[model samples]
Target: MGRIIAIANQKGGVGKTTTAVNLSAALAARGKKTLLVDMDPQGNTTSGLGLEKNELDKTTYEVITGEEKIQNCIVKDLFDNLSLLPANRNLAGAEIELMTVDKMQFIMKHNLEKVKKQYDFIIIDCPPALGMLTVNAMTAANTVIVPIQCEFYALDGLTQLIYTIELIQKSLNPDLTIEGVVFTMYDARTNLSLQVVENVKSYLNQNIYKTIIPRNVRLAEAPSHGLPINLYDPRSSGAESYDLLAEEVIENGGEN
Candidate 1:
């Protein structure tokens, strides 16, 4: 069975999607068969992998609603070992459509179960909100990786996110636990960034990743080019940071 890891953060601009995209790509680059699921209605993860969101017919919306099979929705050949389940603005309505359905929170988990053994890792890019979609991701995922921005008000937002995770563990998925906390958009020169890192480490205690993603122009620009940092600029610091992150994740899972 594949490990389903949801890259999530309720707070926006915290590099959630960036981590999802690059980490998935880096894992693929490391010879792991990876699947990137775009659960966020914004579809940045879809497009970030070189997909044109508007041109797609099938997406996460169809899979989540049971209108389409998971195998039929996968977009292959995005990279050597990476495949994607693209999403678009259409996904934004899934929450409302599934509102009255029975076991709505487990919809994603059930859909993914059908294709569980096909990949080594399944990375879900969740929306930056505590909505029904996020709840669905939590219920589906075995674990979650939180990307925190090294800036002001970072810890304030983390408290609520932690509370939400606890609630999900109690009621939805007892197997769900935090995978790790990754610090992103880090600026080593700034005191604020350094301070935020220290605070998050102290609070999280363990399960925090050692690799800090620097605020690089290449990282921010890769999405516009529809490529991951590894493909966009493999020699860039962004690529190096995400590559380190992938190794950390692999090691955390006790994989050789």
Candidate 2:
């Protein structure tokens, strides 16, 4: 069975989507069968993989709602090894639509169960909120990869996220583990960045990732062109940092 992972953070502008897009792309480049699910209604992950909204027949919103199977929803990305269940503005309304449903927590997990073995990793790019969608992501995921930006208030949202995770673990999925916390947009020159890093480390302890994402213009610009940094500018610093992150992620999972 494939490992289902959710790239999540309650805080926005913390490079959550950026980490999800590049990490999935880098994993595919390394010959892993990867699937990126754009659970975020913003659809940045969909477009970042060079997909057009009109090109998708169905989306992750439909899949989660049991309207379509994942096999029917997935589209090929720039890398043949990587596929996507694209999302769009319509996804934003799913939370309200699903509100009346019982067992909403397991909707995503149950939807993915049928196609669990189709890939090595299933990466869900969750919406940046603690809403029903994010709750479903937690229930469906075997683990979560949190992206924390280096800043003073970063830790504020993390406490809420952790509390939410604990509640989910106690009530829903007991096997749901914290995959790791990745620090993003790190500037080595700033004392603030270093202090924030140290603070995150002190808080999460061994759960934090050693590989940090540097603030690179190339990374920030890739999404606008609808390409991952790995494909847009493979030689750029953004690509190198994400490559290292991929290796670290795989190693953490005991995969080479």
Among these predicted structures, which one has the highest lDDT? 1
lDDT per residue for candidate 2 within 80-126, as digits (tens), equals 68888899888888999889898888888887787778788888999
lDDT of 1: 0.91
Pairs with backbone N, CA or C atoms under 3 Å apart (clashes), candidate 2: none
What lDDT score is found at residue 256 in candidate 1? 21
Give per-model CA RMSD: 1.2, 1.6
Query: Candidate 1: which pairs clash?
Result: none
Segments in model 2 whose C-alpha atoms lie over 4 Å from true places: 54-57, 254-256
Clashes of each: 0, 0
What TM-score do all the candidates reach, one by one? 0.97, 0.95
- The window of 10 residues in a row where model 1 has the poorest summed lDDT is 247-256
Question: Scored by Cα lDDT, where does model 2 land?
Answer: 0.86
Candidate 2, poorest ten consecutive residues by summed lDDT: 247-256
